[model samples]
Target: MSVEGNPGRRLLDEDRLFSSDPSQRSVARRLYAEIRDLPIVSPHGHTDPRWFADNEAFENPAKLFVTPDHYVFRMLYSQGIPLESLGVARRDGGPVESDPRKVWRLLAENYGLFRGTPSRLWLDHALSEVFGVQERLSAANADAVYDQVQACLDKPEYRPRALFDRFKIEVIATTESPLDPLESHARVRDSDWDGRVITAYRPDPVVDPEYEDFTANLEQLAEMTGETTSGWKGYLAALQQRRGFFAEMGATSTDHGHPSAATADLDPAACQSLLDRALSGAITAEDAELFRAQMLTEMARMSLEDGLVMQIHPGSFRSHNQKLMAGFGRDMGADIPTRTDYVRALRPLLSRFGNEPGLDVILFTLDETSYSRELAPLAGHYPILKLGPAWWFYDSPEGMLRYRRSVTETAGFYNTVGFNDDTRAFLSIPARHDVARRIDCAYLAELVCDHRLDEDEALEVAVDLTYNLVKKAYRL
Candidate 1:
């Protein structure tokens, strides 16, 4: 019932995630106060557009917190809890625990599994600050907390659109495939809600050969645009048409989640041959990778024409656990970080578009090793390249600190975009953003104390990192 006997009586410390030195922590507190409530410029994320469009109340706490977030369920799965028990549906529509209270109890009991994790910080923040649940979640209080959150969800003020406005999100972008009709986006645009929900073009299904139903995706693309997708020129035309369509539906960016940061610039005939092989479904793994690489360059060129910002998220060996993938399908926390090469891998694309001033390409990596050695140098030099915020596995306070330390000296602040939540859990957006702002302010405080930066400049940089940089980078 009470958190008094716990290690910390208060669920969150007012000075959490700050410097140890009193002077620097004081500076951090002041800087955080300045920009802590700035509007979130969420240029890229995975929150469902349908929620904001429909303005529906979230079903329950377990559905809101456990089922949708891979960060939550994957950690529970690692501790030997079946995903089905946590209400994660299987691809075959197999039986899963449907009782939300049971799922919440399981998560609350195993909350210790997330003790030192970003998930813990986010969950605690969401519980205490968002829902006004001050007591630490445990098996004893799980039902009480669930009932409180469910009661909040039932209120008109707690619906998706209401929370979007409450969160002060300036502009949020949700990713969608080329085959998607974007009816949800149109609904958001046409509605009187006034929440800015836009879409980002993710052409993986049609671009990546290893994607399931690649040929079928191409055929669907042909049907979507009246182009013969069998031919190379027609395929390109179809993609360009879809980009235009997405742009019309309020999309300002394109996202690519390739396995590697590979890029290629093949001749026209060779490109046609590769396209043929890809369409025939007779391509090898290497061929698929090469085709994907060439498509990256092609997309870059198209970005120049359409003015959609490009984002490349690479170096994840996706679906690393074959059994989980086979059971639950993709994006179920099985994606593992692998060694990524950005210097050589991006050379081909950069060679062609490196000098193009009109293009904006944001590079994201799961490989932290590349941040200082490759990504920072590359971003510092190229007109088109800018480093994305700490992403996927690295969207933590420590990871953010590491990224700022690794890239800021070489690339400078301007060469890096500000934070993007990149999340599926709607409730976690504010918590994630809060963590980033606190960590960034702390970083600025350290720089100020070291006499490397003046207080005024640090304050300005703090505002930029919190709000201005993302808008400018994403052209929001």
Candidate 2:
């Protein structure tokens, strides 16, 4: 059968994610059309800079879609598929599936696992919009669809930098560790591509005492910055110098994925003692947390000096599965959300830097219960604090609506930065941002229907949520 004749080849309705109400759907359509084509400002994400640096065509469909994204594999893993069978490499250099076609077939056979999920929406959008593959992924058409996507990826226009232009992305940021040399970022900057790929500083490895090789990472930091990291003062100086280097490389923000939102403002001597214990590898779990908390405050202070926007996304119990961690290392979707307390936890840092007009601190949470009860009120009050959009598990359409309805009443629209894709999958970037735009429009339409906002005002807010807000919030 021809591709167009296949039932699965049909694309989604134009009003797919909008409200079902006739009046609200009409308003949502109007709002979506107005800002649907605006340039994407992806201020924070985990896409590899190596793709842009090398300007190489993505190798295959499975490598492009299935392997890199934990969203794809986690669902598959949940259904008893081994990560190794899905082309996820093991730590001991053990053999895994090497054939891209086989991986694609496995994903296609289990595509129904993603039904009614945000992953399904993203995958469908990437297939239909990015690769122009009309057929839905299934075991029956897996080979054909894989061939079609591979053909597109083989084309020059489908290359990473070219797709950046095609997706109408104005700027994109990739996260990097302080220990990284950022050679790929330097390559992109020196190249003539003009794609505007930037980096964000993620200082987790060196800051958290519980991190693997934490002491060794500090030694590397000292060597990189020529600062003595044996002492607390020199340790901070080394981090500050690295932040400066990141700024020179066009980094405008810093990210922290600590276990909790704890912050501390300890005196110099107390901080030194914690640092000494951390360096000696004798710190208790409580002291390790204290060290992380103190580092949050220190990172905030460094942001004040260097003007790097600070972002805190806490409450993840990272690498929750010991077996997964032992085999696949980290970020294989073993991270799970825990109950987070932001009210008392952030008070120390907020009280110290809350009044600083120059500082910028964006807060994200895995705990939805805190939206109106804690996050919104805090952002509404603190001069330096802003609420990041629904993140991680909450980046879905329903998640976006829940976020706006929950937080906007107290914090207002301006206190929240616009959407960030926050994805490692390159193709999912545009699809994720598109989801945010549709949901934001649906929300504004509901407001207009209720006489809460004028149509003209809704249009303005739509553009801000789509474009202006991210650029301003991230200082891009």
Candidate 3:
């Protein structure tokens, strides 16, 4: 019998078909083959720009794969592996594992833990396709795979730009703080490399009062934009200035990672008073939230003015593991999904720009309950609104299917943006997109099988959902 840490064991057996029957699997496989090698269009993600800017060879398999990815670390953490052992950085300036080989061995020994998870699929694909590794990662093959991957890392063709080109990534967007100088992005542009790596303005550090060093961030914003961030008008202008700067760096979208979907549009005087209190550090937690809400509306208004796409991702109870958060800081995969209300919460911003034909506001949520109930209906009605794909915790095959099933009837295909891998794991980009394409084709195949749609139509819709829809939505 196959047990854990066996190199011969397959993570997914042939019996585990994505579709019910061999015929359906064959059909899905044909559909997947058509677009399997399509150039990746990563419109939004958390990939570090410095990687592309430097275009340096990756140090090792573990640092490239395990350390930076919360998905990998969180799973290890759940299995009682300390975050420090996983090389996760500590907030209290504590030490972490410096050896990449050790991290790789630890991750390899626990490979069985990712069974039945999307991580397994992604890892398997990377191992097979990227490293040419046929055997499963286990204690026996761990060092072998590590040495092979590390050897590849030392090669010139395995450098960041080389792999980016090899992966056929057409465009990748890296998220950046509004306070960022974008010097790395400038370096990328100046480089002879042709890879289109862009930046997206994430204004949370400056706009959200609860963010650490919020006051200092605002001061820096003022200095950067030459506007008085202490005043409402100047603050708004400073935000606009920074938005333009990001646009100059080829950013087409602005991302807001708010805690909730709450939005507001207070009058100028009221807004000014709120800004004053926030700037003075006199605002309560409630006021801070309200201010963030108003800023969402303000950001929409700015989006309309500048023609930048707006993405609002809300409803995460971030850093929920107080101990882990304290030890390893944010994005340790301790963020929990909560039930989010979009219809009522987004009313204030939608009321202002919902009917605007030119503006594009893409909405993403951690809450699945709101998909059909609120998000679909809202995106169905609003000219400016569109639904972002299943994100973060819900970016799985089931999650993708749920999104299509819940929202397709109301919002339909045109009202939704295409799949965004949204990963720090660079090698998983193609795998993630493949999963989405397969699930979409499978859904379309079901429609064909059920006689709800014809085979020819299903194929067309499959192509559109996988390729055309995302291009149109992201305006690429």
* lDDT comparison, 1 vs 2, better candidate: 2
- Please name the candidate that would achieve the greatest TM-score relative to the true structure: 2
- Candidate models: Cα lDDT each: 0.93, 0.94, 0.86
> Candidate 1, which ten residues in sequence have the lowest lDDT sum?
1-10
Model 1, 90-174: lDDT tens digits are 9999999999999999999998899889999999998887787778789888888888898899999999988888889888999
Best by lDDT: 2
Query: Which residue pairs in candidate 2 have backbone atoms (N, alpha carbon, C) closer than 3 angstroms, thus clashing?
Result: none
lDDT of 2 at 17: 91
TM-score-wise, the better of 2 and 3 is: 2
| lDDT digits (tens) for residues 1-476 of candidate 3 | 22223576554443332588665676666666676677888999988889899988888898888988888888999989998887778888889988888899999999999987888888987887787677788887888889888888899998888988998889999999989999999999998988999999999999999887899998999999899998889999999999999999999999999999999989989988988887788999999999999999999999999989999999898899989877877888899988888888999998888899889999998999999999999989999998999998889888888999999999988898889998988888887887888888777767766777777777777777777877777777
Which tens-of-lDDT digit does each residue in 71-182 have in candidate 2? 9999999999999999999999999999999999999999999999999999999998887667677889888888888888889999999999999999999999999999
Clashing pairs in 1: none
Using alpha carbons, what is the TM-score of model 3?
A: 0.95
Candidate 2: where are CA atoms >4 Å away? Answer: 6-9
All candidates in order of lDDT, best leading = 2, 1, 3
Q: How far is candidate 1 from the true structure (C-alpha RMSD, Å)?
A: 1.6
Of 1 and 3, the candidate ranking higher by lDDT: 1
Query: By TM-score, how accurate is candidate 1?
Result: 0.98
